[model samples]
Target: MKKGTELSGLINKVKESPKTLQKISPIKPTKDETQFSFWIEKMLLKDFKLIAIKEDISLKDLITKCIKEYIKEK
Candidate 1:
């Protein structure tokens, strides 16, 4: 079968099964914590990841530690 034909069939199947697309509740973070998303320079992200790996900690933990230290200094 052709690519367009396959895609059209898939779309038709999805259209026929409207109930398949069920609404889901947003995931709640534990302990009232929230998730954050942001963009950064590629080089900066790469360096940050390397630092996190070297410290054997998660990226989130490393960021949180840095932010806490920064706030304390201020």
Candidate 2:
């Protein structure tokens, strides 16, 4: 039999044995597929922390605010 047929037969055999097999699906992040984040060193992070405090906002909130404001200005 062809490789595809052989694989399909094997899959069907596995499917026939419900107690011996389980299906799995991948879980993906919903946020923009192109979006990404990275870690910074503690010292640099502390600097942003200071900026955030000076700006009177949480670090996470500050990032959103800054980016939004930048986009608005542009």
Candidate 3:
């Protein structure tokens, strides 16, 4: 009876792990998710340049803004 209860507890732990991990994700992009444009372009960089030039904001300020938004989305 003890062995059977132990096995059931192990199965329950396995099932709960996926939901418990929802808040955790890698900081870097994954291998299979890669695309060609992901290498050639970055939205943060482009938006930083465009907003900096158009708004007369400093590049550093625009970059900080973009990074904050990116992290928020993640």
Candidate 2's residue-wise lDDT over 1-74, tens digit each? 69999999999998884674667889787865455498879898898899999989899887777779999999
Residue 40: error of model 1 in Å?
0.7
TM-score of each: 0.57, 0.38, 0.34
Error of 1 at 9 (Å): 36
- For each candidate, the alpha-carbon lDDT, in order, equals 0.89, 0.84, 0.74
lDDT of 3 by residue, 1-74 (tens): 99999999999998874646358766896544433222425776786689899999997667567769999999
Kindly report which residue pairs in candidate 3 clash with one another: none
lDDT of 3 at 30: 50
Candidate 2 residue pairs in clash (backbone atoms < 3 Å): none
List candidate 3 segments past 4 Å from native. 1-47
Which pairs in model 1 have colliding backbones?
none
Question: Model 1 misses residue 38 by how many Å?
Answer: 1.1
